[model samples]
Target chain A: MSLHKKILIVILVASAGAFLWMEQQQNNFTSGTDGQSASLPHPGHSAPDFTLEQLSGEGLVQLSEAAGNANGAVVYFWTSWCPFCSASMEAVENAHRVHGETIHLIGVNVTSQDSKQAAENFLKKHSITFPNVMDQDGAVADMYYVPPVPAVFFVDSGGTITSRKTGAVTTGELEQEISRLKEAD
Target chain B: MTEPFITWSVGPFTISAQMLFIFIAAAAGYGVMSLYLKKLHVENRGEILGTFLTSLIICAVIYKLWPFILDPQLLISPGNLLYFAGGPYAVYVSAGVAVIYFFLQSIRKKWSHHSLDSFMAAITTALIVFSLGVKNYGLPSPFSFGYMYEGVMYHAVNFYYSWLFLLVLLAALILVPSSKKYARSITMLTGLVIAYGLAAPFQV
Candidate 1:
């Protein structure tokens, strides 16, 4: 190839290399796992069921318990370490206060937390009425296809996933989610 | 490696070796692009990259030293070097310096065709270098996602933004003479940098 052609070739190869590297990095950096997140069932797919130790320290709150309520349940995934996750709990509590009894709001707590008591205490202090289930291994989080959280998932009475949000959501937003689920119901 | 280096704050962020590589790659883009300009025998290469690097350093100093930059008696109480990361004016300053750099490039080039690939490569390198800064190595802010699509979109944004920011710089550079090879090269890079910057943002 001529010198000019050589330069052209170099640029094309270099750009292609950069582009490919970028593509690969994007895939890796974004927490992508082939079928890991893809396993996230679309709406209408069966929402996985789980048994979580409730905050009451009494019995486990099974997904089966809320199987057929007129209003579906909202499951929020959070980590004690994340400020955004904590902020999201405040929002969850707020939603509980507004739509008490009508809608079920459950928190799926990740047990990998350094201070489980601190997290629980935060929820208790906030006066959150919803039942919180502990996920020690983060299995439930994977089931929901949750990305680095503060996330929320809405499930219909039939235990099918309806809608979900991944970041900070307000009580009003949760209320909107409830209404949307109710409408779908 | 990523977990301890990473923490959640007011924003979603990343701090791992992989994230480190992205920034390295971006700097490489800067170096490599300069080589190409050299082959094209574009004059004033040092003036371009040197000014660009100097401005970048200034931005970092301002970002980190924001607290000191602020009046001590004032309630704002500015006092650190990492302040630039959180500085409200950081982006504007970086973009502004890039504009000036483009103008410098403009004095040498002819018709600027600044393509997206060229712009993207240079910026990716620049951000990679910024990420390597010792003081404020964590994600500038907290991570968030309201929409399902955002989860996926977030990954692709860094790729797009680096190029876009450079495109903006390139746009500023391309507005000069058209007859000179130096001017032409400068024009192309200017267009690339400016266009890319204009197109990429929310990714950050």
Candidate 2:
């Protein structure tokens, strides 16, 4: 065989080997034998737990504590200034009103970027009724490594982050993600 | 590794490793295509580059407008077109449109199979870099290459893909002589398809 043919064979063999290995791993995850996530906040991993004061009110809210909801939780990180965040806030609020009974929507205001007063005004202006938390020091934001405002994370009842979006999400998209979370439940 | 995503904040906005890598991949693909054309001494270089640019612009436009199409209410925030692009479905749609555009352009240009193969090589380069940026790892594993997330070690499937695509790119550049025609490109695509099929099971 020519060098070209030889190279092709190598690529084929490697891909086949990877595919077989993947099949085994799938079996492992399905059997609950080896599917545990690290401390990082990516999908398929357990969402790092954190506690913060509610944005508009008193008392603190913890992430793992909110995992008791039937469909799980939606963790939203935002600042008052981001236009994308402002636009998506309506969708988040609507989701909360419709599915508030089944899912926990925890909004985190990156207060380090915005003043407490500004954050409160933005929430009030939008008529957001969900539980909004203040990441006063930005510690929780650091824990999740949020990329820009309007970032959203969906955590399953088991605490694993099912999906995450980095930009503004539509109401339909939120509903779709919520439906997937429900299906997972 | 401990941190899977590398992120940096610019003002109030943060950019992640994945986004940075996507830009890098697009540049690499374009660069590779230019280099390959230069090596071949293709006469219609400007036309070929223009065709590629058209496809890229088309993909970007579709991706940006996809959200509005999905939910016209998003138009309420006209500024949203600046930040939010459509989701995975948008990516699929954009890519499909680009591929179809490429086919039509190829027909119009009457480009040879060898030229198309070279184009595939450029795409392979982009895919290699993209796999690296996305950290598309798979299920728990015992291998040393596995990244420790939380506590379990998962397969670095993206790296696996990158390695495979790198080989394909190298083969496209170095192994396939002009006489070999379409052999390397076909093999490289087939291998990637098979690899993607197999490794998808391991992805999180």
Model 1: docking quality category = incorrect
Docking class of 2: acceptable
Q: Residue A134 of candidate 2: its Cα lDDT?
A: 91
Clashing pairs in 2: A37-B149, A38-B149, A38-B150, A39-B150, B138-B202
Chain A (alone) TM-scores for all candidate structures: 0.71, 0.86
Error of 1 at A52 (Å): 3.3
The alpha-carbon lDDT assigned to residue B54 of candidate 1 equals 63
**TM-score, B chain alone, candidates in order:** 0.44, 0.86
Residues B126-181, model 2: lDDT tens digits:
89878877776466765555676656677787887787677666655566675576
- The TM-score values for the models, in the order shown, are 0.41, 0.87
Against the native complex, each candidate's DockQ, computed on alpha carbons, is 0.04, 0.44
